[model samples]
Target: MNPLNPLTPQDAPTPAPGVYVPGYARAKLGMIAAGLLLMGLGFSQFAEPLRLLLFGERARAEAVRVVKTKEGLPDQVLESDRQVTAALEPRDRSYTFWNEFRFADGQGSSFEVRAPVGSQLKPLYPLIDEEGLPTTDLVVYDRAHPERSAFPMIVSTWFAPGMLFVIGTLCAFIGSFLFYWAKKPIELPRLPPTAPATSTEKD
Candidate 1:
């Protein structure tokens, strides 16, 4: 090698043994905690769906009325034209729309319940009829608690739980990977052997 050239692999100093990074333990614990928290939340969100699936009674619910409310505002009724217009336009503020459904329980008790989930853009469930009246929608309510009901076969019913589960699973995988990485010993690349110097003989 030329004397003026930069140091090559053979000339470079040996790397130190890998050690735990500062705050790595704390980071690992934090990731694990966050993952578990999210997982718990995801599981909690699934409770209603699971309860409905196992011990729920299906019924045809009539929409009593559609209520719209902005975040942090009182609920109010919106005209169908206004609702459609609001849905069509870009959202400038957060709004929630839900339908109040009236249905009878197995014991012939009347109960009015709100939709399980609200829509940000438009009212959920019970499509409007030609006469501008609410249509009938299927509702699944817990057998023991008739008031606790949800609209089955809708995306909103499962969206929260599904998203939470996915995010929690990803976080858990990342946390596990970090834990394994933290405990495992690190290895450095081995240096290649240098060629022996050649001697020029007198010709």
Candidate 2:
């Protein structure tokens, strides 16, 4: 038996002399494009306009009136009255809550504000006293325009952008791997047949 020849075919086919174009090239390009897109999306999160577009007025509003008192402590609180319409049935009736607060310009006024039911970072609803009074301060933009207001939610502020950035980074990483994989060449499975050996020694 020939030592050079194996029981199974060991030779692999040779490809054209130039650098090989991987079969997955298109897929790699797609991945690269997707990665770039995700990177762009991540960058957009830091932009003010995108933040405003995604988070709305809350992104630019100034927060105020945070309650600092601990449990069972005496604290001064603002009044937030529930305004409900009796025209409809109990379940069907609509209610509007309002809180009275003084503007920074030394003008005392009342703006509609509501406490959040639950939140991750900060409470959406204001801390209230025993008499349904607001215990916490709220965010405000223009004191003159109370209608443009909202309860603070950290998800829109910190969580959303952070999560988006993380996801985008992961996507970019995966995309880079795919791009590298696609750029790598695959060798052909076929190899050229070997020629008969000739003796180099003199006869």
Candidate 3:
């Protein structure tokens, strides 16, 4: 008996119950781990260089394995071996005690911070700084980050927006595995053919 309320050919399962269980379980765990690592990446984005340090150390190897572009480009775009120092933009954009309060004059009276916003964040590939600045050996690019301390992980590759597709692929693989895992089937013994249907004499 078909269990689906609206039956379809695509909904039908394979002849054998062994169609897809084990692989799904393995990939599911990997997908979950990937998701956790992905979340950790967003956390790193907001927290300033923390995500870089963490993801760089943890998923760096796996990340490098994934292609970043249509022609299989790497995330680490290198312009040169130059190192430059740049200050962070003080990313405490929050409702602190003063920020959360409203002034009687109806004007926002939060603590004003003096931080330099860079004109351009170009040519920096591997290590994006605490201020999301990149590290490349370009002189014009270094005017903002003149301090020459390089974040080593910047050159390690696998740090970019496109890596999300890699994560999606992992999810698809996980889904394929699960599709077979939940499948079940029934078996029956074969009935022997009746012997020639002989007629009885007594009527």
Clashes of each: 0, 11, 5
Per-model TM-score on C-alpha atoms: 0.70, 0.39, 0.23
Task: Find the candidate with the highest TM-score and give its number.
Answer: 1
**Once superposed on the true structure, which residue ranges of model 2 sit more than 4 Å away at CA?**
1-22, 49-81, 84-123, 127-153, 186-203
Instruction: Please provide, for model 3 over 1-203, each residue's C-alpha lDDT reduced to its tens digit, 9 standing for 90 to 100.
Output: 23322222343454442232122344455666666566556444334333333432211110011111112433332222232112211342221110010111113222211111111232223344345543222111111222211132442223442365456556656655554453434343445888897788986
Better of 1 and 2 by lDDT: 1
Clashing residue pairs in candidate 1 (N, C-alpha, C atoms within 3 angstroms): none
Please, what are the lDDT tens digits per residue for candidate 2 over residues 1-203? 22232221222222344334334555556766776676676666545434333544332222233322223545334222221121112342132223333323224444443332223222234435566654444343334454444434434544565566777677777767766655454544556789999879777
User: Which candidate number has the best lDDT?
Assistant: 1
After superposing candidate 3, which stretches have Cα over 4 Å from the reference?
Answer: 1-24, 43-110, 114-203
**Shift of residue 92 alpha carbon in model 2, Å:** 11
Question: Higher TM-score: candidate 2 or 3?
Answer: 2
Candidate 1 has its poorest 10 consecutive residues by lDDT at 2-11
lDDT over C-alpha atoms for residue 169 of model 2:
74
How high a TM-score does candidate 3 get? 0.23
